[model samples]
Target chain A: MKQSAKLNTVNKWWQYETTASQKWFQFGLKDLYYNRGLILRFTRRDLLASYQQTVIGPFWIFLQPLLTALVYLIVFGRFAKMPTDGIPPILFYLAGSTIWSFFFDSLNGTMYTFISNTHIFNKVYFPRLVVPMSIILTQAVRLGIQLVLFALIYVFYYFIFHTASPSKILLLLPLLVLLTAGFAFGLGLLISIITAKYRDLDNILQFFLRLFMFATPVVYPASIIPDKYQALFWLNPLTPIIETFRAAFVENGKIPYYPLAIAGIEIFFLISLGLLLFKKRELDVMDSI
Target chain B: MRELVLKAENISKYYRLGLIGSSSLKQDLQNLFVKSRDGLTVEDPQHIWALKDVDFELHAGEVIGIVGRNGSGKSTLLKILSRIARPTTGSVRWKGKISSLLEIGTGFHAELTGRENIFLNGQILGLSNAEVKTRFDEIVAFSGIERFLDTPVKRYSSGMYVRLAFSVAAHLRSDILIIDEVLAVGDIEFQLKCIAKMKEISRLDGKAILFVSHDMQTIRNLCTTGIYLEKGRIKLIGDPPKAIAGYLNLDTQLSKHTYSSPHEAPGNSYIKIKRAELENSTIIHFEFWYTAEGNENLSIGIMLYNDLGQCVFDLASAPTRMENGLIKGACTLPENFLNEGQYVLSIAFIGDQSKLLFDFADCLNFNVQDNGKNLRWYGKRVGIVRPEFPIQLLNIDRDGAI
Candidate 1:
């Protein structure tokens, strides 16, 4: 019943040839593309599992950002009297916190890709990229819910005080989000490989993430920093992104083209380096992890 | 006419004993700076080969059962073939998609409901969301947990959890399926169902299957070909019966029964045991072939032992003169002589019916199975031998006129 033609045509064989060292550029993008369903499934699982036992399950997603922004509003706006570039303290802090949390949560989730998913990774073979991608998606979903809260407060502020003004640069919202996600995802990829080898890096990484919040001007505006440190501060890559986010949403401000360009290039380099390390390390990382 | 779906050539894997998964940045730093003699890294002595020079090809619609003892590299070989781990040497070339069920419920989340897990697990095994949706009803029915489909899987008993997991795996459409002792879990009825499903998939889809299990009955029944692995090397590759025989012979309690070359047989110069095997059917036939050169008063003796090392019986053939020629001695164990348990056969060549020339201890291992028709008291039949002796009455003593 079998045909000889089937045997003669041997183009589809997948050769698992174990070489001494694999090529660093072979990112297995084809495999990742094939496993898009798996990525979506993982994201759904993470979102559902995040708030399963909690009361008012999805409310926690918005509550987290609101509470953090409230704390920053009191500490920096009322106590320290930090300048807010003439934007409302609550709106300014909320916008910064919203964008910062998207980057923070995505990076936090993606950095632990190897440790958190050790059980599943040991048993099955999917693109290792799927984990970070899903982490980004899960955080993006939470950000979406938090943005709804931000919108409600912005509308209230606009109707009462006429302070919030939408800018043409607001059209770049999707691109800004992409840049934020890319920054977090790229840095998280590199950290994941590091943590996979040296588990001790986990504690050190947590401390650095907290320190990085202040470095990025999440609770305060960029105008407050002295002019001498301005050039040095813009090198943080996240500086221009946060500043551009605030410029587009709550203030009628000009976009910092030079810093934004610098941030974009930095993000591109980080992503390329992160992917190279990931592709190189993912094959044998299971043995160490 | 079967198509070759998987081929592994000279595959080998090595593991460093104490240092597995302990690689840290500190060690990497040390290795970076520290230099050994001659600028070559030192080979750690703890490195051990889990698999060495393993090679085989799997054809479509063929079920290959891999049998080995614990730590015998069976799982390691499966890991390499499944791409969970890479081989230290050699490579695997395969056509078509390969899906491995290394463990049931590999990615199942405890908090997720059964319905959610079905979709999650299906996609993890390479099914699209639409594909999973199409087979959702069939998967649930196959699992027989439709009543509890919405409950969190963590609340389900372990049995229910595995059933749901296996159901998802069973619906997977792959050209090659790799299974590793998943059927060893679950109850008997479910195990049988799993086996039947595997058979149906392999038959209808012409999928190449690689299975590993400790259960010999399942191997003999489900597998078309068996691979006997001993210490990471293929001991035998043939029909299931032959491979199973070779694997059974590897047991410490019962060792090899045949030494095809007389030079390597269990003997010095006088006599050698070339072959000693039992052929079981309605009658249990044992045959031993040997060669004796110096002794003319060679006699063949055999001792049978149960699994507990208890001697069941000892018998000797009449003394016979022999020269430098091949010799054969045979005996028949009547039906029902052996109980339902493992037995070992030890053959000895004797001189003048007194002096022992060569004694091959525990030469053959075999099992006598129950016919499964016992009306009651199905537990193990008492004793080493359960012989059915003939019984008759000369007369009924009707009116005492015998």
Candidate 2:
């Protein structure tokens, strides 16, 4: 009665072959845009959490970092004779501390992207990339505050000594910061992906990042490293990052092209690779967890 | 005629037991055998399939129920289909985008307000902003919490929290919907509404729905077909009634009936007893499955054990109550009798005054199942206490027999 069911409906099948190089990028980009509201809420939450019950409110962003920078300038830069080029000790330490803080903040927070956000991932299937990406973006706001403080410091010094003018190349400052962020984001996301599958990698990362602090030019300039080890500094991705940032703003306001190119390539590579690794894990990490 | 929309073929997942994937000698030996055989990995030595070469073809608009006991690979199958997890072997092919609501409100930001969280939760479920906005009003209307839209979800009542979360998931646009025990949350009215919505989504939208649940009624009401799973393998896959009958009747038919019954129980005053067996024989759960059948009293009998190492109480109310009601044969225990202490319970089917329906004692030591008061109160487990206390007649206007 049904015409032999399946035998009555023989069908032809055609295979579609297509390369989707931009598919992953589109996925990430679309996810980021769609979830912008969520990132916004997280940003506000971060601000609120920092100064929820404080008398001074959200201004604590500037006041807290300013206080710390002042303390470091007094204790380490002046008292302990920690070398601070020709710039005032306060500006020197403040500039270095603020940028380094952003790098470390993104890296340290991204490492826990899997463990800390396990609760969220267990219940829903959001692009897990959003977790670390949102964190980096939020921390960027914090770094912005430090930039404003630097501007204010520049003005005060300009009025007082008339010798603290930033070069026209200071326009490149934002690019340096962005590149640094890219490097940090890529590195953090990469580590987080690895740690999600094999948690033992987490312990090693904790130790490695600590050593990485010294390897980069956070507390000291890269010139402090001996000439032979200068090339070694190039191997550390954060090296070109911090160096370019400081050179464009705190130093001669010009990029060191060779090392900067190396850093840029490393960053782009890290981000793309991090995304691929994370996608692979996202294929079935909830099962393992 | 409906087209075949989904197919899952021979999927299995293996997990290492110890910390950092450290497998024991026994597990290793078992794995060695399975590997040499190339397709023999199972939780049970006698059974070789954590989801045995499972094969099923789902037609468009089909509502399928996956019924399985604990560790039966129901959740695992859902995970694979949802793409949240992968199987160690085999593949799942589906016709359209899939959105799996494993648990509602998982991605809700605690600090974000109800409205803000809707956006977040919607996006997490794979909806774009424009789509969420279009359905935003409908979702809020469905949740019935418009007044508290601006209030942080942290401040919302537990019911309100689940309502908002469920609304977001239900509004997802994917054509293939996989839900895992979501109906186990929310109030009865809300749970019924969710099931209705899910049914509507499947029926009207022509979506392929794979629903996982322990509630037989919901499964019967929602599914066109069902699959019975045991030890990560498909036992039966066919019509809902037949599949459920197979699953419901599986535990009642094992050769070596295994159960958790108190060995040497005590008398009343925080007593517990349990007796699980196959047929007329004793049960050893670690060895084999068990089956049962009987008269009005034929059921999972239970006895209360006190500190003195003996059963002081024995009762079987499920069948007695069901003789005059809809629940035909069920094994249940009243909540009021279970005290807040460690008491072993015997698994048996008995009547009033310790009338032994089938007293197979010393089966396995069982403790009182913990009933959490948090969000889980919405499950079928709520209101288990059916105590009939003789109250002093205070003041009552008898208005009945209408």
Candidate 3:
């Protein structure tokens, strides 16, 4: 029996076809582009709702990094007697905390993308990538606020103490931010997909992220890592980005070209692998959830 | 030739029961070792087919109703069609953009104001920001929540939330619209208005629709064609009435004369319907033993429904003071109230001011045989109720009629 007849030579027809062994490598760029408005709205919603009902509202965004940096200054610079490579403890820790917080927030937020948004994901079909992408963008806004705060402090120290001066490497600030965001987003996406199936990964993710922060040069200057362990430090994808960011802002800080190049290669691979896994799992992940 | 809007070919889905994560990499490696030793692949016994070999076609402006009992793959089909879930097999091809309201208020954040949520939800449903801005007033007006538009949606009543969500979904300008049972959320008035708007869009705007609903009356009223699914396969397809009848027939076939004991019965702990049988294809006899607990104001009600899922008539015994024991009660229907067709009898226990305690839907099924009163008529009866009304023909002067 002729159950259904295939329409041939259709003009402008959209086909939704799938198979058991389908392979997809293309990032759903078209879907992401079309739903860019959703991404922006989601980002706005996240920003608005994050601090709702709080007494200070968005002041928490700036206050969080400020407080964190102060704690790091007292604990690491004042008590631990860690060397700051001639950079002021406040300046060094503030710069590190600001950049590190962006990476941490983006990674941690996107890491729960599938699990936290299961209700919306199960009911609706937009690009699944939109959720993680929106998460990164939302973190970008917080990063912007934190950067302004950092800039204010840097200017104060620059004129008052006449200690730190900007370098031409500061021109690479955009590239540094991109590298950090790319690495965090990629790892977060990969972890989110894994956690969707194995929920135990979610439990481990927080502990891992905390440990990872210490592994990178978030609390102390990269110059203090000692000469022998420098290579091991650069093994982490975040080390070069954070070191380069500090180099851009602080005098005597160095941007190691070889380490930076290796980090870039690693970022590309991590992001590509993350996208591949995300695209493959997104179709059937809801059922498992 | 009219344009084809969507075509689905041999779609199927399989689901595995039990823990999803237990089948981890370690388990897979163990399975591989076992397979290598045995030289044969072992099948997981916990797997069940949610949908199997389903095929259908929809055209522009066509409305199709999908009907089935729970776990019969109605939701599975909708998920695949909406692209929320991928089919395990087969392919679906379509023309033009498809917008699905599988659920209303899918991504609505409680902290966002109603106005903000509208734009957010609109964009999520595939509308551009400019498009949403242009239709902003109309959406708010349709939702009838203009006074509360600036309030956070968490503060809005559930009805207001559903109304706003539905309004945004209604304005989606896709070529095909997929709706699940979201209309069941709001009040009857809002539901009616949504149905009207959907009808207008399909009829005037020429958009195809695939509606999944358990409300048979709504399906009968709106759908031109229907698909009845049973056990993950299409049991019947074609005209809405015929498909509905076939679906009802499947119910009766499963539950014929009597209900089993409490352990096997399809009821709750408060009541265990022991036996339900139909007599003379007209009178319904049912017996249930209830544990009254402490309340004495318990009454039993039975509703009879036809094949179209419309309740034909209902009968309720007046609330009687009773003790906790095995209580027996039987009721008969009004004579000649039902037409010659299949009917399902559902029994429910009611307490104080008609609060439903337990409802056993489709507990008993019986067929009403035609009494040969319409032997001279060439066709079957056309309605659920067949009552003979006396008619008087008046033929006064036809030529003098002005």
Candidate 4:
């Protein structure tokens, strides 16, 4: 059983060095590329395992947004009389809630990356980013399904009811999805890394995301905000993203390019900061966990 | 010359002892303020080094065994090598891809079928989709759970889970493999098969391996070189037998005869030998505390072994009935049953058709000094046991001798 005889002649070597000044913020794109297959596999597992053994299974993905939109239609549209910028209440709320849910689910899912995967992370070494990335991709798939449902509902409202018109700004829909993902991912990663060390932050995060949902234009039109406080509302990065999404679907809704651009810049900064913190903390977070 | 595949230098890791996460934001703020005001770091007092200044080099085909008692930094060293955790200071370099089997079947979802988990686990271990697909048959065959491949892993028995897990880990293709005590799972046959597979991979593919195990026999059987860690430092490094001997010798020196607390004693909740010792080096003295409701067919087995890890004598008590409570038992080995050498005593509590309630190995150690009785015969005894036997001589007629 001696292994000496099987020795090969290859001399290639890879060296790893640990120092106080070690670059922890390299983004590890190469490592991520190397483990891309694992990311896809994890995404599949998350999608499959989420609804496994349940009767409704994948139907729940569509049903969740649909039901939430219905609740908003009855409560905000009828009871509260919230203005939707003259668009049909169902289409307005459906568009806003479906997009909002995608962002919220992505953020929530990424926030649990460290806590939920601590067991696997503690045992194995792959690109740690793959877990969060998989969460984002899985949420993205759910978003895609919900968007198709939104499209079908939009067609029925436009052609059948003749109450809504598709805007040329709808071309920005893909950009809106990308921005939503970036915003959610950046903020989620930041929170996830903080919670790994401070765990108390996790409790605060749920409360914060829930409260922040009201600030976004998911339930009411952005036009309803008083001009004096519109600046304050736009300070929330999600405002511009949600406003732009709604604007692209309705005739009277206006695309706020300046605020959207500001939000986009903020997202880039947030994600960079998030990645920096995540990279620095990931090395030693397992010891703490 | 064999190619150098891996090298680690001055590796050290420090871990905090108390609560891991911050308690609250208010406390964290206060601590930060206090830390800045005093101009002193507060982290030093709360941290202890799990590993310190460990250095090693491995060639392409070397299978090095890391041996130490628990908490001696053997696992910490492996964690550093495997890239699961970065060392606080120091570096490790290796050739080609490295795969770590820190825990077998890591990330195996219970709801996923055995077939799906095979692909998932394989990818997690750095195997590509095509790679897993090609090796799927071999992995399934090795696990011997082909019939249940379509069944969810949750439905698989613990043994089947371990078999499937180990099979996937064993099939991982990499230039270097780092494993920690995972072979302790599964059946003895599977364990041996894993050891053989490790040897074959190292020989045929020239993969370097760093294996950590508390099982000294496996270390002696499979490793080409050994590293003995003690209190976060490398105590000995070289031959496997020598390192294992050093580790065992260190174990005996640290705790001479008695294991004081239940924590120090090795056993499960069912039974534990609270304290064990030797009296006058001849009559073995030991006491065990057992807690079992309706203790029917309960018996104790004691074995004596020499310093070289060879069993010289083994004896078991007859079945005895007892009530539920803290019960103590003492047994004495017959006189002159062992020769003059360092001996380790192991105990096992067996109940109901020899089912093991608890087993503790190397529980107590004692020395025999061989008083002047065999002075003319030896410098040291040749064998493990010196039993007392009767001898007789008879006269025979010369005519009948032919």
Candidate 5:
């Protein structure tokens, strides 16, 4: 309804006239902020969905990661003699696993948000970004639990092993997290779009993620790779993120420059591409789904 | 005489049919090749048109109902309007901060309490944080879930959950409201609340509303105008009653039949009457046949419920002429049956008693118009039989002259 002619001219559905071209972009940002509420709900759902039936709640969060770190320490670090760059294998492996698990959870979980939330999407209209963004927040809770575990181990390593310092790039830890989330959302969005047409991607994502865990340096240090594959290893943007996380936290406050910047750039590119594809798919995907 | 809020131009939507598998894809590709030589097969390569060339406008203070049978484009239009999905062709234009109450709990967390889900569900519908907080109390109170405010919704009963969700939606102050059949998911009282809330939104706020509902009474009460859709096309658009009548005509809910002879039906169809009588009976069962326009005269059957909860035996009429022709119809039951109760009739069409033909479930309901039998029923209708059962008793005096 037109309360005023000027307001009517600016933006109103009655006239079917969209406002200044620049306003649409601003709407997208505001839409994102508004959708943050659903993201919060989704995050809550994601974090607690697994533990809903359990007697002991989030304690499992700490126990699972701690137990996983222990298993890796015995199997790969002690039994196999895997490399840890002269650091205690437990501390080193926990550092890498802490970041890797968060990224993987977000990437793998978000890959199905579109499909999982289709029931809701078909029934209502909100920004689709709420789904992927929710996964990021949900996984953050899981990662937070793991971080507390990492702190306990860090304390043991510091007073016990006489090592461990807060990374100078700890100030940039927020940026690192953003980069990790951005890459996961970006790639997951791309995969979800393809999934509507070719559903095998769902199966591949589950299979390849486990396989990809072996490929990443979660247990063994990255140094085991020969010089020739160093370039190839960089292709997986996670290589440097996981490696940088390990080096900065465990290697005593040293920041790796080239690898961090490369990961950032790669994450930026993937997100941009993913958004483009996502926007295009939003136009008519309900029919396909 | 208020303000124009929205307009659409030649908007159309397309949908693909069939399952998600290899066979569907193979058919799609085959349809694609066939459509290449033609124009505008865009409505689905399987060659089904979900919506075609729809145009409409809405004033700010309007509550319009869209009614249609299944597969109509009512949902398709709502999807495009809400921006959940897009149209295949044409465009929709509007001016406002649009909000839809399509699905109330789109992303509700089972772990979250009612208080938490208020913000979550509000945001899912495009409401801002300040907007949600402003009306949070009203939402909780409206649902009458004050005690369970802190409890997780997963622990709440489905009715309670629907109440909470609907309450959140009802409290929203939005520019445009697009409500789907989601309200029907709630209980009757809750549905009444939802309809009342929408009425206020449309009348008081002057928010342009596009409502889709199967409940005719609700549609008549809430909507000022209506659009009747048939197979993806706008068949009629006018006053609510007229549009509804036209739509119902196409659907044909109430069926009626009368016959002189069973075998000598209107045509060569072999339709024989299994039973007949309008007398009150318990759970009245009437059977008929299935006949096509030009095929074998199939006998379809119907069962009607009358005053009283008593259920009579099954009456079946089958072995139709097996082609198109007039069908036989009848209703029968034992005598002195019905006691007293409200009732509605059910008619099922089946290949046999086991094989289903068509189930027009609960097609019609009528009042018994009680006769004066209890306490002399002074206030009720005074008659020998409830319906004045077309009978007479006469006394013959000794002398006609006297």
Candidate 6:
């Protein structure tokens, strides 16, 4: 039975049309806003579930970066004799690993959004973006805990050796963290869309991300890069954010304001493109996943 | 006039066959570059339309039940309506929010406590913290698991888990709810509670519900309207009774014998139906192979039903001892007693005419032919059973002088 066309009001109705052209870029921003409570609930669940069965529980958040920094200290600082730009090697590695871990954790958490949550996605209707957003939030909370470890180590190294100073660029600390998170969110969203269809991409993505850390100057200072490769190295979006983050606290690394600004623009573009593609693929991904 | 809640037009879904997620990259590239016979980019030969040209409308307070055989697009239609998957073509327009319980406890975390899961499940179903808080006591009370609220759901029994999940879902405040057989879970008492809750919501709250279920009894009890789907299309849509009849008729097969051998027949170890078939004209013949371990006073009962799921007759043979072998039983229907229509027969094994040992429903179906001639009437006679009784014509005299 067809109703009168005049009764078809548009404001309150959710219209699902088949054409890909109309509203292709909606991004479900309003729905995401309305369902923010759902995001919080999911984030809480992830936070609780991650440590529920572990013996030491949430301490793993602080231990992960500490152990990674220690491994880098022995492998790169002592064995390979990589320079830390006149800063204490442990503090240098801690700062780099702490910030880089945030990016890594965020990407790892959000990249499998579609596949891991397909069960729920198949049954319920909410803003699909909430899953990835909640994942990002969970990682951010873990990053906060890791930051406490970073702060404690920085204080110990600063008072004893006077090797680090808070530079004026430290004001940009929040901005730097935001840029790193944005890049991860963008990359994670793109990876999830592709992985939903091609599941084998996950193995390749993990390997590629492992290799990508070498390109971002996470274990070594940016100054160690040879002058000939400097131009090419800056092209990596993460190079600027990582360098800026270390420079803000340690003051030994260069700020690279122009490059940082360029990285910001790049991250903004990447996130927009990620959101558009994610929204487009969200509905169809359910079937393939 | 009731406010229209949902309207779907020409919705269809096409799924590619064979290894969707694991398809080779080479094939994907070829699919992108190659042109089909119609010059379109797509050219997959092995594909099927899971749903095709399905159109329907739901108004406020109307409960519609969807029934279909497996792979008949019932799930695809629900997925499209709930926005879980996009349709291949056409569109759906709906006012108000839709909350679907394609399953109970969809996003429950096993490691999380029941109390936390309640909030998580509630929010996933589109409720806010304030709303969940308002109904928190009601949900807990309905589930009857407040003692285990702080315990992780992994420790809850399967029934408790399902009860908690359904309780949260039942409390969701939405204009439209799409449920897919969630009531089939839990014990019968909880199921009845859920059915009553659904009825109350539709009646008192005026929420529109689109339910998909294979349970005819629940469909008849809960739905105001029904849609029977067949092979990806809407075969019938009307009142619940009519649609259910259509669905049941579509499912009925005219098998002379439901099982070819006694070993494969449907029954327990005590009794099995060896053969059940319609004999010459009106004689219904069946063979039951029963073991000697069964009770001696075992009686066989058969109930006949018409297309509308209404029973026409129920009768049982006298109690008799069954040997450890096949026993022949026959019940002859009096000619011209049954109306000319399709009828389903169900056999029940009873002990001492009191306890039901086993019941097999709609095991065989037969059509009573309308070959009987009635000279007085030219058209068909209507009733559940058409019986001919002796009639004598008498004329009343003018002054009682007959």
User: Model 5, B151-253: lDDT tens per residue?
Assistant: 8888999988989988888877777888887777978787888888888888888888888887677778989889988888898998988887776552343
Candidate 4, residues B15-56, lDDT tens digits: the string is: 766777654668668767886887334556666788889999
lDDT of 1 by residue, B1-402 (tens): 798888888888777676656677777777556544323235556667788888899999999999876567998888877767777778777877788888888889999999999999998877889999999999999999999999999999999999999999999888989999898888989999999999998888889899998777888889999998988888899998788767666345433367777677666666666666566533223333445545558777777766544578888888878665666666777776678887767678788887777777656777778754543657678777887776776866668863
Native contact fraction per model: 0.50, 0.24, 0.66, 0.71, 0.50, 0.73
Q: Which ten residues in a row have the lowest lDDT in candidate 1 chain B?
A: B281-290
Q: Which of 2 and 4 is ahead in lDDT?
A: 4
Chain A only: TM-score per candidate:
0.93, 0.83, 0.92, 0.92, 0.86, 0.91
Model 2 residue B44 distance off true place after TM-score fit, in angstroms:
11
Instruction: Tell me the deviation in Å of residue B172 in model 2.
Output: 2.0
Per-prediction TM-score of chain B?
0.65, 0.63, 0.66, 0.65, 0.65, 0.65
Cα displacement (Å) at residue B186, model 3:
1.7
Q: How well is candidate 3 docked (DockQ)?
A: 0.41
What DockQ score does model 4 reach against the true complex? 0.41
State each model's CA lDDT, in order.
Answer: 0.81, 0.66, 0.81, 0.81, 0.69, 0.82
Best by lDDT: 6
For TM-score, candidate 4 versus 6, the one ahead is: 4
Deviation of model 6 at A7, angstroms: 11
User: Which residue pairs overlap in candidate 6's backbone?
Assistant: none
lDDT of 6 by residue, A210-252 (tens): 9999998878888889999998888777888777767766655
DockQ of 5: 0.37
TM-score of each: 0.78, 0.72, 0.80, 0.79, 0.76, 0.78
Model 4 clashing residue pairs (backbone): none
Among the numbered candidates, top DockQ falls to 3
**What is candidate 1's CAPRI-style docking category based on DockQ?**
acceptable
Point to the candidate with the largest TM-score.
3
